[model samples]
Target chain A: MVPAPSPTPMGRPSPPVPARAGIGLRHPHVQRLLDERPKVAWLEAHSENYLAAGGPRIVALDAIRRDYPISFHSVGLSLGSAEGVDPAHLARLAMLYRRIEPTQISDHLSWSVSGGVYLNDLLPLPYTSEALDIVCRNVARTQDVLGRTILVENPSAYLSYAASHIPEAEFLAAVAQRTGCGILLDINNVYVSTHNLDGDALRYMRSLNPESVGEMHLAGHAVQHIANHQVLIDDHGSAVAAEVWHLYEQALEIIGPRPTLIEWDTRVPPLPTLLAEASRAEARLSEFRQTRIHCYAE
Target chain B: MLSDLQAALRTGLLGRDDAEARAAVANGDGLAPDARIEIYRNNVFQSLVGVLAAAYPTVANVLGEAAFRTVAAAFIKSRPPRQPQLSAYGGELPEFLAALGATRHPYLPDLARLEWARNECYFAADAAPLDLGLLGAVPPERTPLLRLSLHPAVRLLGSRHDLVAIWRERLGGGGRAQDAGGEGDHYILISRTGLEVQMTELSAGAFTLALGLKLGLTLGRAAHAATLSEPAFALEASLARLLSHSTFTSFVLSDPAEEVRS
Candidate 1:
């Protein structure tokens, strides 16, 4: 039997991701996706998870990469580090990028590596000008090595730095404006960080330079009590919360539509449950496109 | 200044909570600075412990959730991962468990070793097994001088306990472990063959041969080692079973002159 043609052919540069909703490609879903071929607009992969040279994940990713546009969402970039981005990590990422050719790549606007130890969590970064310089330097260095622009995502915060001079959105905007990178506006993080830090969610959303955003992420967060007040924890463990979904709709209005993603990492349910979340985001993106079309028609 | 603040925050989260970190953070939305740092502290520890749980679910199953979390938290504090790739993080866990809980739970460490080996084999590079049929090309007299290379994914784990049986039982393989105790020495040969990891218990003679070969012993010398352990060791049977599944990647014919003679 003749093999079916792949949407994105091998050996070509990665094709751009469409302005629709996709899902984070967790390990459990890789084989199911191959067998079922679910209709997600694209798949976003954690770059570190797939760096092994020869493994089941790598093999599946090669087959899956042929059929779907992939986005490389990395957690280890540590762009906010003052110690500089790890050169060895950068080289490994570069190797994977050359092989997979993902359409979009991203990391958080936070540091996780400290004193040469990977803490394995996205630790918050103070938005001081000094941090801004360090982040920009690290981001620019990353772009130079990877030979493509990377998107920096806003992090979910539990506390503010006494020294943070810039707002979260403006800090991300400046990172995009200065480094020639783009913002991967994570709406759930906006809700969690603002609600936790006493910032107005609407104002933070409006503060971003919408054109600088290349992609968007929506996920569920957990609310916990911290010293008599409610704090939202950005644990991608469940369905997108109603309030976060509303914030996502507001983001669609302000930033227009980008390649949105629904991430459910912690207690990742079955594939259909995740696909349903992605479809909801897809519906919002479709609605945004329709509204723009109507505006042009009027 | 940026590095200093980071160090303080690191100390607050991973190390004992420091007053400097609490002061460095801004108290907002009725949450104290220490409480904020606690939030991050919980995240860092919980996520890492979660990673260990995924890698060694059988270990967690054996220890139960609360006990495993305690052990995992202590392991995290002691030997935190230096690599960015979290997949490579918990390689030291088996040895760590042995050091901590050997007296209380003797079999737990060996069980962890088996799981860790299987994890490594899963990500190891794929290499096609050599066709030993090509042995026809070598002169019959020189067959004993041939040295073999095990596949990159091959790992031989020897324990006093029957880790394979315990692992099976814990993974819901049904029947209880009739001999899960440290009764006889058990050897496990683990290797990835074509996307699936194949693990089988090896006999004394077979394990000795594999270990000898892995330590660069020639075929004749390895057979000598195997026969030393088991008088009735069947070389041809074991060789056929191992070679059939691509256990060894390549073989080199060595000169008899290189052998150290008594």
Candidate 2:
């Protein structure tokens, strides 16, 4: 568990992920990618979904990893679990890491399990000092074990904790500061949380330690009407809303050019449609870069 | 506070009478306890139902979505997920169905077990088939005492009824429902090779032989076990059947001198 060098961009060549867009590699799209080797910067996979020993999922990942730089996005690590991260899940992830050698590793800043019972959904956590401390310790332990500074993404929430004290942005900053881990800012989550909770998404983005921000996630959401209350669900089953994409553009301004991933998990469109969504992000990044360069010259 | 906070959240989410979640005016939409509690309740049940569906698609198909949801709700209330990976969540559903007079799906448990085994085999590791090259190096006389090792993906199941046939019938694989009817016993050998699951009907003798080898029995002892289960069992034929199915990934020779590490 020797730590790989501090990933704080300490004069190392930024990893191989080109400052471009990539699509989340779902199981349905595996065969297409294997057949044609689609023209995306890299592919991202849900780590837990591919933990099989010798199945088609693993085989597909093996073949795709050779052609495209893969990022292992884990959902089951449960970094915020009060029970702490599951050890066997971590061991299985470590084994997969050794096998695939993904370019980046990431998990969400939410708890999916409690009291040894897994809820499977990324349940929201109460933002408080005690929870922040627990999350940072677990992130540090995970980084120490994985030998890499894993990226912790924000979770889309439906409700807020009554006993909470700290703000979500401050909590994320504190976790990053304490653990020396990086952030995978999911702009869709920020938009979903801010609009529903009535907070300033822009200021929330500004509060983060930009240096620690390594990657960005943009996904789709479904609006649910419960008693005339509009709660946006981060249901990755539709097109990326215009507002979230605008926030993604703003994120590019703050974080500069990081590896952006267009994630669509359920009701995934055809391979070409996903690639088209990723291309939109690519176009935005290039436009941002050109504008930044022209303004610098001026 | 840490553990208590978790317990309170679980209690609130599970909607148990012992919920420690303090009802506050600032919680839920418009801060209503029923609505707040309802949010968690919906999430818990919905998630548990989703896990059951993933683990038991055949059962879900058998019962359809509505009844499956009812059964899933009951299963969740009766037995929540104890493991982080939801793959292991529905272990008690089959037994639970057997006890509950309702639902009337008699073969649900065995069907659930079959789906669970399919998942297990799906995630099991890939291995090279038994390299007889090593066996070729072993001396001739001591080979009779060799004990074979079954692959991790190999599972032998014996039942008093045609469980696999019933499962196939539900899957519309052309198996008749009558095939599972009547009071006759059945044996099956399930294995995964080349990323696809393979299930073969096994005779009593073959099942005995597989069970023995799985338990580390030597060749002679495995044959004896098969004979005990089926008197007319032919030892050589059963051995050849297992080998042809590529069950043994490696073997331990009877004599230490003639042993070749596989």
Candidate 3:
């Protein structure tokens, strides 16, 4: 007789995702992933999109999970909310994580919900001591419930707050240091936020604790002119910018190789285009690995 | 101070006032603080509006893009998503549309309800259908005490308009609005079989039986309810159809001993 399903982790010993490049799994590309079963290292899906109890998408993801390691990249955890994490949301995510058994689980450092209203966009946070305390508490609570560590990604912001005394990188490091959580560094966000806010992207990259970075993300951003000033919006619509690619290489040089994901949420191109982007990231990762080996030999 | 900052940001994004929130945002090189905040406000509303459009394509198509945007923006402002799961966010939209009373087509609300039902069915939980052989094993006398549970994905919708036809037409089914004829009742049974969420129009008897079964009535009582609604209701045929469609997930025999204890 089949055993009754339990809420505990299945303890299925699946292979861990290699420190190679992967693609963000979107609904448009599910059938392609199923049909082709590409040679990519892993697939990351937005956790909120797959929170449904059951569907073809969930079924497809389950089928695909067998072939590739999956990562749950959440955009709606609202980790920076002052009111703390929502129990219901956390419970649902926990349920999903139990089912999917993702190789990695991550959300943004920014808050998306406040006062019971979910804005559905990653709003920037003021990196004050108080904000840091709240985020760390929320992260701890999240990790405690999921029974696993979650990586928090940095946000791509159009604006910063006057109240923020601590730097973004410092705040992220503090959260990791305090909560024992890892960081999923999105290189495009670092490039965009620093460019828009007039900070040094390289400096921010160097400030982060490399050991805390479990994964990296590379996505395209759109440059928009607001009030005659160039503002790069993290739209994830087009090809990865050359500048962002340069920064990714720089980040690899600093932080070493980690599991990287190519996120193209808006105007998602055909599977081949995303695959090509993943290939580009994989090539860089390989090149970085080779350079490291050569340097070690020398 | 954190609460104040978040409150100001909320007001700045959703309300007309940005003065308080603008003070909190540090000004960039050349862009005004409010302009920067405007980008976030635009993103928030646009993304939520896009979600509503995706959930209710028929509503968007019927209202047209410009009008749909107006409605979506209004809906977002009034009933912002309380939960992070956006797929389940727009369930209240049918009532909101009905309250608007701006459409020439009064059937729009029902169409929206149908779409929402379809959306719910699309994401509803998976379940295994009841085994016919299990029913065969039960003594014939005990069949009347068996309470069948509908599948989690099964949804019954009753509309005063020919909602199926209207929804199909909006989905490019090629039927004109007039072809739906005058107002008539429609009973729709939506269930997910494998990967597909299938919608079917149920007969009066079958609808009554399904509705009764959903309400926790036993098989004999549900058949009685079905026959009461439609004299020609054939219990065997309806049972066969429901079983074939994988409507009922499982059933429990209502024990006389347990009933007495209760």
Top candidate, metric DockQ: 1
Clashing pairs in 1: none
Order of quality (lDDT): 3, 1, 2
- What TM-score would each prediction reach against the true structure? 0.94, 0.90, 0.94
A88-120, model 3: which lDDT tens digit per residue?
Answer: 999999888888888778999999887989999
lDDT of 1 by residue, B38-125 (tens): 7788888998998999889888887878999998999998888887887788999998987874555578888899999988888887
Over A258-284, each residue of candidate 2 has an lDDT whose tens digit, in order, gives 888999987889999999999999999
lDDT of 2 at A225: 79
Cα deviation at A47, candidate 2, in Å, is 1.8
Superposition error at B255 for model 2 (Å) = 3.6
Whichever of 1 and 3 has more lDDT, that candidate is: 3
Cand. 2 Cα-lDDT: 0.78
Q: How accurate locally is residue A103 in candidate 1, as Cα lDDT from 0 to 100?
A: 84
Score candidate 2 by DockQ: 0.46
Q: Which segments of model 1 are wrong by more than 4 Å?
A: A1-10, B135-137, B173-182, B256-262
Instruction: Tell me each candidate's i-RMS in Å.
Output: 1.1, 2.6, 0.9
Q: Residue B22's C-alpha lDDT in candidate 3?
A: 96
Off by over 4 Å in 3: A1-10, B139-142, B173-182, B255-262
